[model samples]
Target: MKRFSLNQATTRHWPMPDLVAGCVRAGVTGVGLWRENVQEYGVERSAALVRDAGLTVTSLCRGGFFQEPTWWDENRRAIDEAAALGAGTLVLVSGGLPPGSRDIDAARAHVGTAIGTLVPYALEAGVRLAIEPLHPMFSSDRCVVSTLKQALDLAAPYPHRAVGVAIDTYHLWWDDTVWEQIARAGREQRIACFQVADWLTPLPAGVLLGRGLPGTGCVELRRFREAVDAAGYAGPIEVEVFAEDVWSRPGDEVLAEALAGYRDHVAGPG
Candidate 1:
């Protein structure tokens, strides 16, 4: 059976119970959560709430932002939190280019160094690290990892070694090299995670990360699924829509609509 996981951002205003409840209402079997929510609700209780509702936590996002010289302590704590949630993959958003640095190469180096530093800690915690590649537009401020290929390239040396890429369509949809990269990540055993939401226009500056429901935008859903599955991936297809507009509505409505959109756009015609 195919499983869907609720991305915590979809119900940003709700408590963890409410978020997991929304997923239950939508018939989704899994949930992917951000660290802030865990901090707010407390990991043990949050994990209990989801499990009580019978939800599978696909991943715990995230554990990066290594630009700070003193960030390791905080990141290690995040790994411990993921362990509490029983989430196997801890997504990492290698944060932005540091100030006074026009050089993207320097930022990329930071990401590599950060991951190399964190991988062992994660493995010891029995959790994997998934490096998420943000869109190129976010290169200067949000995440330095920008392509599945780029992320795979970085983690290739560490294959099956508890570090890999988080395959999110919102960031990689426009990449001309997606197919090749997905194949490479698969062959190399590097697809640590998978997620989706569509891309829309006129996105507010801070919410450029806000993505539309899957199948509503330009992503070729069936082809995307085929490529991932072809590479032998059968993980949860996490719904990670981050729209401010959607969040303003009632949580149940947003979840129902996102699930319906996924069904109509992805599971229906194709």
Candidate 2:
């Protein structure tokens, strides 16, 4: 059986050093990172800390807003940061149409072009870009890739080793075509990362997280696992919960719940 792990969710309360320490203490095999945390801790320092703590950096949480003119600089910088952090996968959350622009199709085109531009740099740094399709509700502002189909298209140009799509259950579980996408990802050899967090009650803010507890929420992680296993994706299945209520708890308690939840409900027998 493969192992699942907690991301920086436990370390959100502490600095990067403390967070890495917490991850080691919690017995997770891997971790995820955000740009803010990396910036605060400095890439070299954060990388050293995480390595010293003996953790795998599963992914860097972002890169891809191809919207307004300002987005170019920001996205490039994010890509640079991901490379510096030694993360193989850079989860891309594509940007929406600019203000006063009612063109979804145009925004989609921009996403394609942006990825094309970044792919060479990503390859140079040994990073694989993993396009993430947020829920449709976030189409206007957060991400233009509102479906796995769209993300797959964005990843099509590059070979699977260079480009892939992220499979986040919280974002994809609602899709009718998730199974097909998983199959396609497998066919393309592009299942970069499999992340989990269930959907809860009324979504708070609804863009970035709105994450829920596993099993308690509505997603069928067992089905997701079956699809992934069938697809031959043997990477670590990351537990990424972004609930405000959950983050408010003491770091250890939050990690305990997350780890136990994954063990009992996600990674266990279905």
Candidate 3:
């Protein structure tokens, strides 16, 4: 469990201080936070809360929506927030196609260029931009970058330390080529963040809150973990489920179950 981290979204309703305390009580020393939550709690105060509790902010969830007019400014502020919280990685969810537009190719190209534009700022902030390719189900409305290969390709033009791909099992486990892409990411030194969540059946209507906890669905959890490990990734394995069932329970209980899942399925007999 040394590398296990609790992604805040798994317990969305938990307050920042309570979440920090919950992590401490559960022996979880790392977390992945959302931008809105940090902002609501006061970024510096959130940073202090986590730091004083001896927990590390593994990555900040999201700073991309390239199609938006304000993307540049928004991402700059997100990078600053990440730096303030001592989070080394900023996950980018390259948004879906611009409304009513069918030009997928153009959208993707723009994302790459936008990322290129932000490379200098990211480097200056001492933050790595991690491109997270959401599942293809989200390709139409959530993320245009929907494959590990695509994410890697987008990150290729930038310095490895400046831009990289985030490997989230929930978003990528279905792709057969992911293992090889993971290897490619390693060779390129572009594997910045690794997140874990199970794929559940009868996905909820919006598909945003349907993620299962580790080992709850068909995904071969350990396979993905091993692939990332073989890809030279030795960082926090953030358990980032977004199920309402998981969130409605007590955070500590959920944390315990998440740890058990990580140990049983992801860590694998260690």
lDDT of 3 by residue, 1-270 (tens): 899999999999999999999999988899999999999999999999999999999999989999888999999999999999999999999998898899999999999999999999999999999999998988877799999999999999899999999999988888989888999999999999999999889888758888998889888899988988888999999999998889899999999999999999999853
The root-mean-square deviation over C-alpha atoms between each candidate and the true structure, in angstroms, is: 1.6, 1.7, 1.0
Q: Write the per-residue lDDT of candidate 2 for residues 61-142, one digit (tens) a residue.
A: 8787778677677877877887777788888888887888988998998888888887777788888889988888889987
Candidate 1 TM-score versus the reference: 0.94
Which runs of model 2 end up more than 4 angstroms from their true locations?
Answer: 9-11, 205-209
lDDT of each residue in 1-270, candidate 1, tens digit only: 256677887778878888887777767888899999988888899889888888888999888877766679988988898888888888988888787788888888778877788878888999888999988888877788888877887786664658988998888888889999999888888887888788777565766756888766777766776788888788888878787887888989888887887677655557
Reference-based TM-score of each model: 0.94, 0.94, 0.98
| Per-candidate count of clashing residue pairs (backbone under 3 Å) | 0, 0, 0
Regions more than 4 Å wrong, model 1: 205-209
Best by lDDT: 3
* Candidates 2 and 3 compared by lDDT, better number: 3
Q: What lDDT score is found at residue 45 in candidate 2? A: 85
Worst 10 residues of 1 by lDDT: 201-210
